[model samples]
Target: MSSSSKIRVIVVDDSALVRSLLAEIINRQPDMQCIGTANDPLVAREMIREMNPDVITLDVEMPRMDGIDFLGRLMRLRPMPVVMISTLTERGAEVTMRALELGAVDFVAKPRVGLASGLNELAAQIVDKIRVAAVAQVRRAPAASAGAIVHPHAGGAAAAAPVAASPLLGRLSTEKLVAIGASTGGTEAIREVLVHLPADAPAIVITQHMPPGFTTSFAARLNSLCQITVKEAVQGERILPGHAYIAPGGRQFALAKSGANYVAVVDDGPPVNRHKPSVEVLFKSVAAHVGRNAVGIMLTGMGADGAAAMREMKDAGSYNYVQDEASCIVFGMPREAIAHGAADEVLPLAQIAPALVARLRGAGDRVHHRI
Candidate 1:
């Protein structure tokens, strides 16, 4: 392939080892090439100006402008796809959540130990992200909501306080449930849906393609911005209404029944469609267990991880929503779901929450109209 045909990438990290390793991995891909490497944001700024790469792998901490500040500036001036390289630590996870809010396409958590081999082991994920980032939708970052409203000390705050919960939809059918799935640019998309849901919304089970350690912080970040409580799902817990359960990274979470009540079944199952906490696993479970009582939503993501199972959802009488291409960072999954005739509604990202609310309210009216 011609040089111009390859995806151009810039590696930015404080550690020389990380920078070199990332560059090496990027170059090894036939479809991608690392054009430059920088030890800090100041150096990276110049590299970006001169090289104008398609994607950048950035570290969270740096000497001259930190990655967050650099990312904030970059997103405003010349919004471009960025894949963050974060350490697998609590602090690292917190900063990564902030980076995603700031418009990063995705992140790769570098192992805390054995940097070289760890990065090699993750090389497949690293290059795959670069491939996705090259085509991801990267708009300017929304202005900082934390700095203006709340102090930015610790525990990454939301862009702003959540809007008040919508009026309670009283006594939803005991069987009603919501199943959602996403990947690639899922963090923000998931947040957009969860924050707009009413506090009394039907029980929500979510599968956002994220690895171990990150989902904990991701759930916390969403919980801070959402009216409904959000937490990582645990094994065998009876799922409750008015809360959202996120499948833990490295585990599979599926909908099941415990007599009359719904429950979450988390397991150490192998990756389905190359993902644990796979959307297919969750959607298939919801299809068989919840059937017509469930609402399946396929949000912005890359590839067709759950398209077939989502069709199974529709065949089982579940109503489904797939995010439209224009509003998605990568339309692969939603497009595939729609192609499979799974989506009952194909809507933009911004309109999805409102549509879901309206659908639920309408369904409630139909169920209780005689009263």
Candidate 2:
């Protein structure tokens, strides 16, 4: 294929070795071709105008202009898929979230220096992210003439409005809980959805592939911003209405009936789909305990972890939704679910949250009635 048809990539990093390594890895892939490298955002800005690569791999730390600021300008002026390379630290996590909010597609944790194993892991993640970035939809930054302000509330409202109009809106029945599963790009994707929900939205349970310490902080952040309560799930905790319970990383979370109510069960078990808080485990439990009284949403992530469980939930009569390929940062999970006939509706990311809430509020009635 010609270079124009190939997955053209630009590598931007302060470290020469890291940039060279990334370039080598990207060029090794048949579908991906590294077009150029830049030492900093200043050079990167010029290279972007020249190369117009399909994707960019950007380091978080750089001199003169930080990666975050460059990302903000790039997304506003010329949006394209970007994958942030960050260290595995609290600071790294914080900056990574900021990058996502600024419209970066995903992130890869930089390998720890001097560790062969770490570098190998980083190589694998970089390759995967490059592949995903190639196909991801790059939304154009709203034109300045559009009078778009980056107001947090307005940004959220703009993101939520389309979700409310989704086809899933008219397909639901009674108010039931929604269970969502994701990894990788999930932090920002989930935020976009949850921030749009009403204060009285139905109960929600989430399993995001993450480490132990991260989920708590993520849940806290979501709680602070969202109208509904969001918290880390604990064993034996009652499932309350309008509250979202996120499964802690490093453990499996399952739902079980306790008398007239449902409670969360956190347990130690072998990882499913190479994930601790497996979406399959949660969806299976929801299928058995909640039956038809649940909504399963498989968001953007890698792997087919949630496919079978979503099928189980759908077979049991629960409504199911998947983020469409065009809106997914990584389409693996949702693609699998849809291919397995598990998803009842596939919607764009911008429309998923409000669509979910509307389904929970009886807008789904029209769908079933039509059936």
Highest-scoring model, TM-score? 1
**Per-residue lDDT for 89-179 in model 2, tens only?**
7777778766776778777776566634565656766787787777776665432324332222123234422223233333132247789
Q: Give the TM-score of candidate 2.
A: 0.81
Candidate 1 residue runs with Cα over 4 Å from true position:
145-168
Query: Model 1 TM-score?
Result: 0.94
lDDT (Cα, 0-100) at 38 in candidate 2: 95
Point out the worst 10-residue segment of candidate 2 by lDDT. 147-156
Q: TM-score for every candidate vs. truth?
A: 0.94, 0.81
lDDT of 1 by residue, 144-195 (tens): 5544432121123433444466544567746789999999888888887887
